[model samples]
Target: MNFIPQFTQRSAGTEAVVSLPHGGRRPGRELLVRALIGLAILLVITLLVWFDRDAYSDSGGDGLTFVDALYYATVTASTTGYGDITPVTPGARLINALVITPMRIAFLVLLVGTTLEVLSNEVRRVLIDRRWRKRMRNHVVIVGYGVKGRSAVNTLHQQGHDLNRMVVIDNRPASVDEANLTGVAAIHGDATRREVLRRAEISKAREVIVTLDRDDSAILVTLTVRQLNPSAHIVVGGREGENVSLLRQSGADAVVTSSDAVGRLLGLSAVSPNIGAAIEDILSSGVGLEVAERQVTANEVGNSPADIRGERVVAVVRNKTMRRFYDQSVDTLQTGDNVVVIRKSEARAEKERSERD
Candidate 1:
């Protein structure tokens, strides 16, 4: 099985936290249903008294009407009796003692349901926050769930990374809602702020990605994340080529200039159709060809990159160092070398099994 980290995010002061929708009615709906049931109880009592009008007396020394019965039922069910109406016969007294009293208790319980639900929401929030924080060690936090952020996560997920270990941080409510809809936790806050990063547990994160719209904001967030997690692998998205060095200096491990990358693709498409098509195929994930990294197995040791049967190996990583496939230093694949290869997405399972082989 592939073991990948999970995801989580928290906003300032634990205010904007929501997980995937679980089974339950909405609080408003629940309250409405309970109110209807309480009303039903009150109506039943009112009808019983109204049908036997001679059994009840009014303070005005007049025959009891349906309105008087309703008033009596309302006051009695609410436990706010005004002593203006009283049961005059054994039948009315008996029904009040046996039926109305128990339903009065039910009515009160339904009213209390509203208060209980409010308290339950607060308690549930606390428990969920605690559980999430407890399981958040060494996870990935992707700040700013824009196009870049979505692409990065899509690549990771297609390559068998765990979506549960992915947390999205965005200042937009819509972005946060989208993350939750996709089953990824989200934090709604400014990524450049210290408290926001702390809320995401940045210090414990293994990887952080900054994909903010503004290059300046991305740089600031990268610096803040780096200061918080000196050992984390932070990848940033840059809008302009000029800010590449500034982003790197801000502590981004790698920076992708989106505009330049797109511009090059556009140029390639105009100049050479075949080259552009091949590049697009490699970039697209979860279908057709995909780029992935896997561990070298016992079956493939001491073999050159060209010897791999299923996938084409492009680079080899050994001892924390990467060597190009053409580099003679990595001609023989070592037992623990990690190879970056291009393989069929549909055959991903076969490729993963190759690691064990």
Candidate 2:
């Protein structure tokens, strides 16, 4: 049985705030349905009284008519009780007190409750956002919720990173909502906007990932983030290879060119399926095979790459510089060196086993 390595990080307890767009309001289906049902009930009760015209008296000296019934129903259901229409018989009065009153209350609730709930929820959301902002620090800011951005987030989660310490900012409301549904903080706004970036606490962010669909937008967002936090790690995804250098120049510490990467993957798959599969496995976290960086073990110290047992050492990172296994300088592992290894991910093994059973 393989064991998955897990890391524990402290929670910052900061939540994401959402900025809703202002537009024309449309009634929700629930509200519309309830309103129709309430109206139907009121009409039914009014019609019942109107059919038994002798049961009602009118101060206006008009014998009960369909118009009178409709007017009475409207006034009664609204609790206005214009006093122009009165139930004269005991049957009518009993029905009014027992049936009409409750229905009237229901009608009012159906008509007005949705608005009150919306307002209450808005106030509560604002309060929660204020609290969230106060506690946010050293979080990861994702500038877009596009495909690349989402994949990056998924990998971070599988690597045991604290998602609560991450915030997603996107101009698309749908994307923001999707992030929120996954329990990550999301802000619906253009990431290139300084105010939006500031609201996301870029100054205190430890890292920022820019994955805007447009290379220009990603570059602008990266520049804004870099200006906000000179020390933060800024990684950007550019759609075109030519923009990769532009993105890096715009202050991105790393730039992944989408088209070039896809092309490379395709080429590798066509040339050697096994090698391509191995690369894919390593790129995908918590999968069949994975690449991970770990501190040099006590047993590994003073040992060559070929001497390490159980895992394959692809490279060694010493003093923030990476050297491949083929490099003679990295032949002997030293203390403080990080080993980049390729091995079967225990999480994937367990998941496969579970699926099999």
Candidate 3:
């Protein structure tokens, strides 16, 4: 399915702009500015004609009053030319031809220009939306753009994930604008709705990340997404451990319970700060140390886990099954074994050294 992302509001560069459906907010401001300027011009001309009342003839009434000048200005600018008021003197005729006539034309142009600009913008928005949706496929759909969602996307970006292939769905206008600013496609709507998921092309998505603020909302979103795309990998974040089971039953492939994970970290910190620190270093990206996985080296293929050098080998994978270093079968590494190790993250090596000093 193609993902047609509608841009409700987006800020462009240095300008603070807010666009909306049908007619944008910023364009309305522009129209207001134009209207004010046109009114100012009309006022100035009305004063000029009123001050020189002797230069004109009002056949139906006495010499022109302030009210007549106002009425004449309106009818003249609108090209009504009622003919009751005529410029009898050469000075009045010259002023009407040189000054008043031009301002009248300008007033009409500004009104017509505003209409044309709106039409032009609508066409442009539609074309760009169509083009974006056509190229979307096998992308990643993020249901929320909150703290956890930002972290997840940042980590994926560090791993060289494509931002263009990711779509962010958030109900908050600010969140959607932020996502667009960061060069990601975003949809501003409730993600739990089936139509919204379909617009995000959930059927063709490779993965879906649910990080809503509430567990109940997350569960509803997970169930909806799973029903839409059963084959896609869905990773959900639950604030409480008790909600993890519900999220799993809702069809989330993996559920990360933030409360439980943080509690465990706190417990480990109280017992052994060094162990907790080490675990944190491994979990952190582009910092101190990191956990990485690699295929067994040629020379290390026939060697035992204890014989490997440089990095600490934590586990080995063979035939899709994981075996820890303490496991009997993992003592001997095989040809196709993949090793998971704790090593200094090469990407953050320089930054880490600088910060330590």
Candidate 4:
């Protein structure tokens, strides 16, 4: 969709023509067909006039035959009234008033309709294109459309979600178009601006991921987003390790050093290949399960891992080693021990219902 605005101005005596760019294929073809048909009809009328010149002349100075009537209709419809061939008789005058006048009116209506249709199509195309750009949900919004930002977008796109809502905000048109083409909503404006955030609908957004090249710009974006919507989880990718803490202090929930994440992944791959594969699968594949950390605080049954009724505990990530926690284990629960539970949708719903009751 073209982001350029269509502007039109009308003066005191001059008519304004708003030339709409060719929108879609169908409407453009329809307009062309209509104009061609109208031209064909006018040509046919002219041919009939040329064939019966004697019949037209029989009425003398008063009567206008087929040729004269045709000529008058053409000139009037074209808005080029030469006044050379005047209708003389009352019959001819009445014919001119009815046929010629109505023909001119019809031509004007067709012209206006075609023009408006094209313009409407252009506007609709832009809206639809914009909608496509913003179709992702629960997505990470990157502030800058730079290399790191682009890589993040590609990774997110590869790691498909139920709702792929990703948006990129940069003050450059080319960057915006690049983002848009990648099926990400790219708004051309300052990410630090409050209005730009408003356009991005930052409040309801799940996560705001800032990967601006400069530390100052990323900091500003993080601050603005935090101020606008405090609850939104903000993640920033920065170069300097020192600035990471500063960005976090400025309200970034998590600061990701691109180098650090890469290094960590590389180190983990060397130490534990299987663990690295699992991590990569979780990050890259939608089907990969996520072992969420849920603290079992309430001992409705008893202060024991085995006594925690309802849901199944898959594993216990204690001392960085995953220990399989069985259902029949009589072991008591520790206060700070992390429980890795396999999330079952039915179990979750039951828990919710029981809590509500």
Candidate 5:
């Protein structure tokens, strides 16, 4: 099914910018700058004609004064030559032909350019949005851009995920601005609302991360997203461990207890520093060690997990069910199975390539 995103204003008052399309100047500011430039052009003409007042005549049968010079400049630059004031000298006429004409042309171009930009702004945004939407399948939708959301994005980025495939939704304008500054699309609205989720294309997203500050909000957003996209993998962050099951039952594929995780790590660090540090290193992405999942290769099929070189197989996933390496159901590697392994982040591919060679 093809869905086209339309950014319609839902309010009666001044609307906030929907998207920072090109991250360039605001339309109002751009028009103001162009107007200033047009005025500068007019000022130059006025000064030029004023300095050469001797070479000009006025319709009142008097010498050309500063007011007459200004009047002539206004009419001439606008291409509305009233002929009330005429340049009589050969030098003045030459200056008009060479300098004034070009300035007049430049002024017209600026005027036309400003009009075109204003007229084409909507069209440009629509075209860009169409193109972006067409390529946005299986993208990630982040419900919040707070600390957890930012850390999830940073971790994904470290694991070589494309930042362009991410979209952030935040109720705070500051979070939206910060998200845009990172080159990712952001929508400013309540993520728990269905309309806001539709704007983020949540139905087509492969993964939805709900990291709202409140656990109840996260559960609500998670439920809403699951209703919109049942197939998407939803990971939620809960403030307390007691609400973890509630978040999961709300259709989250995984739930992490923020306080419990931190508390356990701190306690482990006090008891066994080295083991705690190692666990932290593995949890932190793109570092000394990493945990990742991959499909079992043909060569590894029918062999024992210990025979696989370079990677330590921790679990085998079959039919979406995970089994530890010591499980009897997965003693022998199978063709259509995925293996979760722990390996050196920097040398993961190098070790596998060496094994193949």
Candidate 6:
């Protein structure tokens, strides 16, 4: 067997030798300074012990040693009085009072400084992460930080989308801070401006979501984003019964009206509450079931919904009837049938991953 030196073996066993040099080097330096200060305090106690030993012994009947003085200083700094060691002479008491007061003040200062440094480091880490996330490209930029925008961001994040790749552009500083706290890259800027859109990496973004409450702002943002990046997939939110044809004409790929969707949901609930509950469960991200529309190519499945890449097909909206496509043996998937696939969000994510790759 090869001979390994004891120092080398101990170094490998503890791993401390490798880490000791770099372990909180700054804190170590501070600790070293404190240790030197403590040593100087002990040296002062030694000098005082030599000078005041006779005076202390005259009152206590036992000579005051260097260790006794050092112990007294430590106890006074920590605010833990043992009552066993008492200074009797006026000179000794005066010395104790002078040294103990400064030691207590120094201890308090050190404690506050250390606490503030720890908090400062944590804040710096969060700020750095926020800055790094803002600089990333190919992100899905959400133009608003309202309820709709927040809901969309939460859904995407819960679906395991990278928060760094999902940038939030809001006008309010509070909204930006909220998004940043959630690890979502957020910048405070007007979405209607081309410069603001550029700052959000509009040209490089894969998707742009406009969820502003103001219809005019939404329309203007849509137009601007389309003009800036014609190829980006733009999704806009509109009010109830609001004509989004102009928005679509302006180049939004999809327009979602919350008023219309909510009205429809309420109507469905009035008719069949269980069905509405099921629909809500499917739509809710927490339920893990997503009602996703998958486009079938002519060459891929030969127009067959049964051949789609999922476990179950809930319904096929063909001829606008919402017929059951679960057990249907249709040979061809018609061009217009929006295949409603009810499956786990993970499955949809996997499908998206495959398509992207």
Model 5 spans with C-alpha error above 4 angstroms:
1-33, 53-72, 81-90, 158-160, 171-183, 303-307, 326-328, 347-357
TM-score, each model?
0.78, 0.82, 0.77, 0.48, 0.79, 0.54
Residue lDDT tens for model 3, 81-170:
898998889999999999999999998898788789878877766666656667778889988988888888887777678887898888
The Cα local distance difference test for each model comes to 0.82, 0.79, 0.82, 0.64, 0.82, 0.69
Q: Could you tell me the lDDT of residue 179 within candidate 6? A: 69
Say which prediction, candidate 3 or candidate 4, comes out ahead on TM-score.
Answer: 3
- Clash totals, every prediction: 5, 0, 0, 3, 0, 3
Residues 223-342, model 2: lDDT tens digits: 888888999999888899988888889899898888999899989999999878978888877767888888998977999988888789999999999999899999888999999988
lDDT of 4 by residue, 1-357 (tens): 343322222233432222121223444467789898677656654554444443443334665556576775587677787766654456555655676466667777787888897789667656654554355445567788888788777765553532136667777656765665555555666787787676666776788889887888889889999988888888899877778888998999889877777778889999999878866655442344433556657553246555555555766655545567764442556655677664434334566789999
Deviating ranges (above 4 Å) for candidate 2: 1-16, 19-41, 107-116, 349-357
Positional deviation of residue 180's Cα in model 6 after best superposition, in angstroms: 0.5
Residue 32, model 2: Cα distance from true site in angstroms: 5.0
Give the candidates in order of TM-score, highest first. 2, 5, 1, 3, 6, 4
TM for candidate 4 is 0.48
lDDT of 5 at 263: 97
Colliding residue pairs in candidate 6? 303-332, 303-333, 304-333
Clash pairs for candidate 2: none
Greater lDDT among 1 and 3 belongs to 1
Off by over 4 Å in 4: 1-78, 82-111, 114-168, 172-186, 203-206, 270-275, 287-357
What TM-score does structure 5 among the candidates reach? 0.79
